[model samples]
Target: MVTVPELEGTFIEVETLVEEADLSEGPAAVRGVLAELNISEDAFTTEQYTDAVIAHRSA
Candidate 1:
């Protein structure tokens, strides 16, 4: 996995490829996998890497 320069740490990204019509199911599916991996919902981040990088540079 590539390190996120802005965040200064490598991150894990879990994704579910649901169709646009089924977009609502994406989060629940990913959450299930994360739960299995022992990752709690409280640690989940919705911020994209590009957004993080921009914010870091702006700061």
Candidate 2:
């Protein structure tokens, strides 16, 4: 995982595929992993991230 200070978050890489079944745990599941990494749940801004990705793609 790499800490992206600009994004105030880490870019984590998972070797295996995360299938639809994996989402069964919902948001808590994601929060759990982030907690294990010592990442705060508040660091994620969904709409902001979506816009950033779109802007990057358009660029």
Instruction: After the best TM-score superposition of candidate 1, give how far the Cα of residue 57 lies from its true spot, in angstroms.
Output: 1.1
| Pairs that clash in candidate 1 | none
For residues 1-59, write the lDDT of model 2, one tens digit per residue.
66544454556632333568886556666777777878776665455555666676687
What are the runs in model 1 whose C-alpha is more than 4 Å off? 19-24
- Over 2-49, each residue of candidate 1 has an lDDT whose tens digit, in order, gives 687558866788978999999999989999999998888887888888
**Winning candidate number (lDDT):** 1
Q: What ranges in model 2 sit over 4 Å off?
A: 1-24, 48-50, 53-59
